[model samples]
Target: MSLIIIGSVAFDAIETPFGKTDKIVGGAATYASLAASYFCKNVKIVGVVGEDFHQNDIDTLNQHGIDTTGLQIKAGEKSFFWSGKYHNDMNSRDTLVTELNVLADFDPILPESYQDCEYLMLGNLAPQTQQTVIKRLKNRPKLIVLDTMNFWMDVALNDLLETLKLVDVLTINDEEARQLSGEYSLVKAAKKILTLGPKYLIIKKGEHGALLFHEDQVFSTPALPLAEVFDPTGAGDTFAGGFIGYLAKVGTINFNNMKNAIVFGSALASFCVEKFGTERIINLTEEEIAARVKEFVKLSSFNIA
Candidate 1:
């Protein structure tokens, strides 16, 4: 079975307090696929890039054991590119540039081989595009996790709501959760969103950690504190990848399994912020990942009377 991820695979120029970069491989799919590859061996990607996207970049993804058979390369067009600068807080940033070249008209076409998908990670993309991927798949995946943002809620709200009906899990930040549910309290928000669609909801809290909600059950995990956060870009996408990747590896769906998945996801996301773009995650080792996951365990571990 394959763990398929669909989203943007393109270039990014970033400037943080620690350093700056010209153009690096940084997109929702790029980060998520890389994070998932560490846990799920049969990881695949579905995305489009233009002539400007170097072949070396595609090779990099392949080197990580990611199947790029579904990746489309269009000629005579520039790949999607984004540039952003982070503030000292590292949590906030300003978009310096956004060129949605080939991605402007991206029509996700799932290859026949991708029909074996058991786990699907829908990275941040337009609500309509996300819906199209679900409709195109011959068979529904065992697990379908959708990652979205406030942008979609502001523009294509109805489409996003409809897409929610097709996904089993939904991942969004604290702010987005509030915006989507129109409730200030996260508990209330989770209830409202759950009613709308997804059986499970994950509200990402950045440096603070993440929360997992299903029915009347809720699990909260604290974020691993880091000395320095070089670049916050793609951390959420990386988390989503690890979350679904771990789930795919376990080959099961339950509240307990989801809790363990969040720890692995947070561990992967912790590594993502240590450097710019995908620099840190691309070179992670088994030992390093295990150590990080252990650290997460210690953060919330304790004895009860």
Candidate 2:
């Protein structure tokens, strides 16, 4: 069994309060697959890039034990590119540019080997694209986690709702949760969203933490406080990658494991923000990852006298 990640794999030019970059390797699958490679050995990516995407970057994924057979590189075309500048707070940003070149007509094609997918991470993309991937799968994965944003809800809501029904887990930020469920109270929002689809809903609260809702149970995972945040570009995708990667490693799916997965995912996300692009996550050691995860444990652990 393998873990499969499906989303955009393209270029990004980011400018933050700390610094700026011209164009670096980015995209949802790029972050998620790299984070997942640290946990799951058999990780594969399904995405489309253009001639502009470098082979060295593709080589990077292969070095991390990620399979790229499913990645389609179109000739005589440019890859999807995005440019954004973050505010002083490092939370809000303004879009400088967005060119959906090869991505405009992406067709998710699965390889025969990927048919044994036990875990699937559908990173943020068009709802119909995410849904198409699910339909193409030979057999239903043991678990399917879908991550989306307010953009989908604003435009392709019907498709997003239909895609929600095909996933076991749904991950969205607090504002998106409110928009999706039309309830201010997260608890109430979660209750209403659960009826639409998804056995579990994770409401991500950027700086504060993340909430996992399943039935009457809710698990809140704390976010690590960082001294400096160089970039926040791919943090959420890294979180989703780390989240699903941990679950695939443990080879189990349940409420208890989901809580722990959130912690593990948050740990990876903390690393993501330490530097731009995949700088921090790419060179992580097992001891370093273990220590980061321990920090989460200590941050949350307490006892009454």
Candidate 3:
């Protein structure tokens, strides 16, 4: 089954305690597509970039077996650019710059070939844009997962809620979950959010871990502890990618499988924070991923009699 990803594919300038970069290829779709490529075969991305975006970067995605046929390159315009600096904790960040050149008027145009994918990931974007993609699909995907931020909830609550109704799963951080559901307790928030429509909710807690809530059941996955976290950008998107990628590979949609997917996603996201942007994830070997996943099993496994 093919998986379709829709979000921004653009440029970013990042700064952290470790170091800084002028500009790198970084976006919600970029990270998600790269992370998903390792688990699923037919990964197609639908997003907009600018002519300034290097063809080599596009080729890099192709190297990973990701289909870029649906990526639109806007002639003469500049790709969206963001600059941010992370605090010493690495969990909080401040935005220094945001240029929405191409993204300002983004209109996702899905190629006919991408219309039938079994899995769809709507990465962080305007709620209207995410909704547009779902509406454009001739047939609903077997699973639809959405990732959104507090920004959208603050500006477009109605549209975001409307889009949530069309999705099967929703992924958001702890803070956004509270804001969306108006509940301090995540369990209560999940219950309130579930009434809006999605059958599942994943609350990403960054370095702490991720929690998956479905019906009355809950699964918690811990983040791998490391000597250092060089950068935190794109880690959340990477987690989302791995979560859906594993599900797509196994072709199952059950709570048990989703629990495993959360572990896989956390493992992949652990790699993401080891370096800046997508540097750590780009050349990861299967062996490395397997070993990392083993680490996760060791970190959380226990038998209670």
Candidate 4:
């Protein structure tokens, strides 16, 4: 099964208590594709990057067996760039810079081969752009997972709502969920949001882990307690990647399978924060991932009489 991921492929400059970086390859699609590649080999990315984007980064993606056919390279334009500094708690951050550059006018053009994708992941992008990709597809993907943030809710609520009706799942942070539904209670928010369209809602709570809501059922997966978090950049995108990748690999969407997918996603995201940018996730081994998953099981498992 092939998974299509659409979002920005850009540069990022990050600062944390441990250290800082000048500029590194980072973006929603970049992290998502890398994380997804671990579970699904047939991962295709659709994003645009300026000439400033490096060939080595592209090669990194290729090494993981990801298809870059839809990655557009613009000659004169600059790639999107974002710079941010994380607070000591590693839970909040201040945006230092955001240069939309090529991303400002991004128009996703799905390659012909991508038309038959069975799994679609619309990473954080403009709601209109996300909808465009959906409309362009010759056949609706078996599963469509959408990730968004408070920024869209604040600036483009109407557009976001319109696109919501077309997706199968929605992934957002706790705060974003509350804002989108105008309900402080997550259970209530999930119920209201489900009425908007997506049957599944994943409310990400950062260090607290994630919650999966579908119909009348709810599953909570706790975050792996790390000794330290180096940088939280791209963790959420990595989570989304691991999630959809697992589902694609298993070829099932039931609640039991989704619970396992959440664990896989959390395991991958735990590795993402151990090192700056995508360093840790890039070289992750199957054995390492398996060990991390075991830890998650131990953290959340208990026998019931």
Candidate 5:
């Protein structure tokens, strides 16, 4: 099975309760591609960067078996840049700067070769851009997962709602859920969002963990607590990567299968927060991942008598 990820490839300057990074290779696609590559051999990335973006980053993706032919490099302009400062809890951050640069006018052009993808992950982006990618797919993927943020909810709620109709699963944090659904309660928000179109809704609660809701059923997983969280950047995209990558590896999208995907995702994300950017995911060995998954099994496993 082939998986396609469409989102950011940019630079970020971040400050967290743990420490700070002046400039680092980050963004949605970087994290998602790295995490997903651990499980899927054929991961196609679709995004845009500029001259200043490092070529080694492209090589990093390619070395991990992520096809980056779909990634565009705008010759003269600078890449997108974001700066943020996290609060003491590291659960939320305040934006300090947002320079779209080359990404400001991005019109994603998916390569013809990426047309047959079986799983599609649309990471955070403008609603219209995400919708365009979906409409261009020649055949509908088995699962189309979407992630968005409050920025879109504030600026383009109507377009965001329209795009939600095309996805099978939607992943957003608890705050974004409340913003999108205008409901204080997550249960009510999930119920409201499900009616919009997606069959599954994941409400990410950062350090608190994540929750999955399908129909009337719900599953919750806890985030791994670490002594240090060097950088909180890209953790969410890492979660998405692991979640979708596991599903692709198993070649199934059923509810039972998705449960495993969630656990895999949570485990991968746990590794992400331990370091800055994609450092942890890059050099991680398969044996280590297997061991972590076993740990997840132990933490969540229970026998009903």
Candidate 6:
């Protein structure tokens, strides 16, 4: 079984109360592919970059068993770039610059080798682009997870809604959940959004951890309280990476497997915020990750009897 990730691959410049970085390799697919490599070796990545994008980064991912055969490198153009300044809380930020560059008119075309993937993760992108990928797949994946932001909801609600219908799981932050459902309470919001199509809803609350809702059942996982959060740019995508990676490793999507996947995802995300961009997740080890998941189990464990 293989996992396929679809999202942007670009450079980012970030500043926070803690510190700053000049320009780093960062994007939805970049972090997702790195984090997922920990659990599963064969990961196919689909995205558009430009001639200016570093080939070394692509080489690194390929060496780690990530297939970039589907990665589009547009010649003679600059890659997409984003620069933002984070607030003291580390949860919110202001976008100072966003250059669409080659991504402005990106139309992802899956390579022939990418068509057989079993797990499809549609990272935050144009809903129509995501739909195009789904259409190209010869067989429906065991599970299709989608990650989207409020930006798309604001600009393309109809297409976003259509994409949601094709997916089994939808992951979004707290504000996006509220805005999508028009409900202040998360419980009510999840309920309302469930009606929108996805069987499972994952609400990512950065520093606050994440909530998983399916039917009448709900589970909450706490985020590790780190001494410092260097960058939170791609943590969400990293979470999705771990989530789908674990499922692909286990070869199932039952609730019990999903429960473990959530813990795995949270553990990966904890390491993500510890460094700038995808730095920490890139060199993470299985032993270290298992230790963190053990910590999470202890943190949330209790005897109510």
lDDT of each: 0.94, 0.95, 0.94, 0.97, 0.92, 0.91
Best-matching candidate per lDDT: 4
Q: Which lDDT tens digits does candidate 3 get at residues 1-305?
A: 89999999989999999999989999999999999999999999999999999999999999999999999999999999999998998888899999999999999999998977999999999999999999999999999999999999999999999999999999999999999999999999999999998999999998789899999999988899889999999999999999899999999999999999999999899999898899999999999999999999999999999
**Model 3 error, position 91 (Å):** 1.1
lDDT tens string, model 1, 1-305? 57999999989999998889999999999999999999999999999999888898899899999999999999999889999998889889999999999999999989998998999999999999999998898888999999999999999999999999999999999999999999999999999999988999999999899999999999999999998888899999999999999999999899999999999999999999988899899999999999999998888899999
- lDDT by residue (tens digit), candidate 2, 1-305: 59999999989999998889989999999999999999999999999999989999999999999999999999999999999999999999999999999999999999998999999999999999999999999899999999999999999999999999999999999999999999999999999999988999999998898999999999998899888889999999999999999999999899999999999999999999999998888899889999999999999999999
Model 4 scores a TM of 0.99
Model 5, range 1-305, lDDT digits (tens) per residue?
99999999999998887678877889898899999999999999999999998989899889999999999999988999999998987766899999999889999989999999999999999999999999999899999999999989989999999999999999999999998899999999999999998999999998788999999999998887677777788999999999999999999778899988988998899899888778899998999888988888887779999
> TM-scores, in order shown?
0.99, 0.99, 0.99, 0.99, 0.97, 0.98
**Deviating ranges (above 4 Å) for candidate 3:** none
In model 4, where do residues sit more than 4 Å from their true spots?
none
Task: Give every collision pair in model 6.
Answer: none
Candidate 3 accuracy as TM-score: 0.99
The candidate 2 region of ten consecutive residues with least summed lDDT is: 277-286
RMSD of each: 0.7, 0.7, 0.6, 0.5, 1.2, 0.9
Model 2 CA RMSD to the hidden true structure, in angstroms: 0.7
Is candidate 1 or 5 superior in TM-score? 1
- Candidate closer to the true structure by lDDT (higher is better), 3 or 6: 3
**Per-residue lDDT for 293 in model 3?**
97
Clashing pairs in 4: none
Instruction: Report the error of model 5 at residue 229, Å.
Output: 1.8
Q: How much is the lDDT of residue 217 in candidate 1?
A: 96
Q: In model 2, which regions exceed 4 Å deviation?
A: none
